[model samples]
Target: MGLRAVSFFAIAVVSILMFHLPYREVKTAATESLNQRQMLLAKQASFGIESFFKEQRNLLRHFAHSPAFLELSKVGKDVIQEEINDHREFVKAVTIYDKKGIIKYSYPNPEKVIGKDISSQAHVKKILREHKANVSDVFNAIQGFQAVALSEPMFEDGEFVGVVAFLIDFKHIAKTYIESIQVGDDGYAWVISRDGTELYCPVPGHTGANISETSAQFPSALAMAEEMQKGHSGTTTYQYNKIRSKITETITKHAAYYPVNVFDNLWSIAVATPESEIYSEYQSFYKKMIFATVVLFAVLIFFGYTIIKDFNLQKLNKELEKRVAFEMDKRQQQEKVMLQQARFYSMGETLNTIAHQWRQPLNIIGLCVQDIEDTYRHNEITEKYIAETVDKTMKSLELLSRTIDNFSTFYTPNEQLTELNLYSFTKQIVSLLQEQFESLNINLKFDEDGTLQIRKSVFFDAKVYPDVLKQIILSCLQNSREAVQKRLRSGEISKGEIRLGILRADAEFSIVIIDNGGGIKEEVLDKVFDQYFTTKSVSIGMGLGLYISRNILEEYMNGTLSIKNYKDGAMVTIKFKDSKES
Candidate 1:
């Protein structure tokens, strides 16, 4: 009992865990979905920031081909000043430089920048080296304001004349790009350079500072910077104290970063949201899911206990039923054997009485016929008639005496297995009932399927119980008799027929009895030999005849008896092994 209780407890724990498995999966999937959604939003914010910087660079490319910047010597100073005035909100100053990176033109005070060489700037160096448009990262520049320079090459008739450059203010870019976007409750966006410098930050004083190495000595910041340098995009989690929780302690934050590539320069944009804000909604639901799983597990364990007990009781009941049914079957078979033996004994006594009563009278009749023949000797025709009459009388008496002896053998024990004369044995068996069949207008015959060399004297050694063979034939013919009688009453057949055929194969003898009677039902054909299985009236059948006959043939004879439907009736076949000649 102790072990059983332990097992039950273990199963209960497993069942509860199984019931909770789906919710655990659901929680995991929900977290993944949140992560993907945050990543998607961060990507969009990054794309927006890159688009803003790209727009300024595109404006510089367009201005480079404005005819004034391309041919600055011919164009008036007012055209350049008017263009700078138009972009004054985001642009700090505009300048045009010659191929040598010297400032040949300027907007907002050209005299201060024209003679001085400003070609040492990275954006100018890129434009001179590549002869293409370029944008620089955030830096302190000619405008005395932190900015990114957008420069494009200007050409006159496919010959590079100079470059048009626009210096856009960093404060303006961040205000438009990063400050407007939002993530989760504690989420914000920022822009950084490949060197891990915070070029744009939501915090007021954090710009231009590097956070690549954490204070806790973790390398998360350095790893992110490396990813940015490689131009890769993905999600990361790091210990971040900048976005503080309610306790004002350090906590983890999930961040998604994407590279911004506009005008052949790289920057990284990132969105960070606190972990607490990500899963706050599912916390209560998780508790309820656990409670439901526990309740379901308890109910299943209770049902298992009750069902196991009930199953044991039912199994015991079935065993008891089997024992009772077995006893009843044994008793029924014993009663059937007893009844059969008693009937045989009664039949033998009746045959003996008939022989005693009829033998003297039959002999006396033969003697009287002899006297009449002697009286008619003088007339030849009369003598011939008397002789024939006497001969037939003697033959008839002898046949009757032999039939009586044959009937007496029905109960006689011939248990020693011996050879049987197929022809003579079958003739005697049929002769016992031949007169009865004839009185009922039934015809009996024998046909052969295979050739017998000495056809008149076919014989078989008994591998079967000979008396039992007689019983099987007797039972079958009796059954056939009843079937034919039923059909006659129903007008189904005008005359009844029973055929006994003998066949010889390689090493077997087959005795086939075919009768014109009601064929057996297909449904019960296999079960007809089972004890107490029958389809006749209870008064007329004990249902043991075929069952006993089958046992006798199978057990004592080492032979087989089978029945099949043939024509309008059933054909019973008995096959004995070893049909060796005697």
Candidate 2:
């Protein structure tokens, strides 16, 4: 009887603790979840606004340096009109101001404000003083709308000549990013400048009012505004009075605010909701928790015996998971080893190519030495002759040194992305293998197509892992050399030809290599890129070249490697998407 009484006492204590403990925890968790949600919304809104400002600033800066703008004549006015027409969604008007801040031209009603002076404006003064780009705070514009100005100083021959500016529609930006944000039924977003002037607000009268004056009635809001003005991001609770349907009421609100940094200005975005809305469902949640507590106690008592059984099963599962993880790690290590071995094999091939490159230079140096000796023995070695021979020998030695340096650069490991002109980069790779191809009587050529020729004026720059790209190109060329050599030995052709061409598209470009060694057999073509699948003798290759090259292109460079039968031979193309593609 005593043991039964003790068991009942323990159950009551556990039930009481679980019931009360969870209520506080659940309430705290609900508040934190709301805070986090609001903060995320604010951050997203700020990011969108900042991006818009940055893009506009860059556009203005680009326009400021254009040949038309530098002309500072009627041509500059025409250019401003073109910009406004092209970007009508965000650009309301464009104005060009002389170095003294007197408006020289304004689009879409230039006569109204053309002769006006704006040197008193903060952003205009900043441009004249600093000769730098500036993004202004929201202000009333002469076009009778709220807008922000992005201005850049224009320079001619290193001297500041004038300023080019764009007036962007602030309301349009807010509607797209901030006004569309809805945290809950009553939650809305607003933006304010660093000076506390409201840029966008759902509240009708609060849109353009400074928060310091409008928030006087709400002390908590004043305090929160102070924090926001300092560029601090956080969550807070405040109280403000609002009128709905002719009834005035004071309501508590929760808010999260974040800062948005544009060129030289700061803006704050706030997402706020009524406190009643945040806790509207809490009462129902508490009622459910009460029922859950009773059910949970009964479940605990019934499942006490099964807990030990499940614990052992969990232990077994954990052990199996560990074993699987270990095996995966081991397999990854083995792949690394295989990759390294493939690199070493490629290095050996590069070394052989280097030897081919050095042979001519070495021969030239040897002939120079022999000429010097013969000249000296013949008593005809004048100062001029000795100097010429020494100069010739030095040139050959320099050539040999340059060959080693190029090879060293190719083998060096560089994992960082580098911007390179594809035309020049490919030319470098072709130069490396040209000698090796010539030694085998294979003609390797690099050419540019019509698209590439057109693109040359604006140079095709690609971000790539240069060393890895060089290695892959060399491997592809080596394969072509071997194929052509086979044809040469069989007397199928007097000269073997391989062409590497640059092909450009609207949003991407390709490096295409074509060889006339007879295409791969249709049956084995599909398996060419598979690991360890080689048509060459085992002594010559381990069949990892194409496989590894494809993997690197896909995984490291975000590119594609493809092969197809073309004409009498095979065409291999390495393609990368243009980074500038939007």
Which candidate tops TM-score?
2
**Can you write out model 2's per-residue Cα lDDT over 354-449, one digit (the tens) per residue?**
888989999999999888889879999889988888898999999999988987876677778877788877877888878778777888888866
The TM-score between candidate 2 and the true structure equals 0.49
Query: What do the candidate models score in CA lDDT, each in turn?
Result: 0.68, 0.78
Model 1 lDDT per residue over 94-161, tens place = 88888898888787877888966767877777779889887787897755778888888888889888
> Ten consecutive residues with minimal summed lDDT in candidate 2?
536-545
Steric clash pairs (candidate 2): none
Residue 528's lDDT in candidate 1: 74
How far is 481's C-alpha from truth in model 1 (Å)? 90
Q: After superposition, how far is residue 134 of candidate 2 from its true place, in Å?
A: 1.2
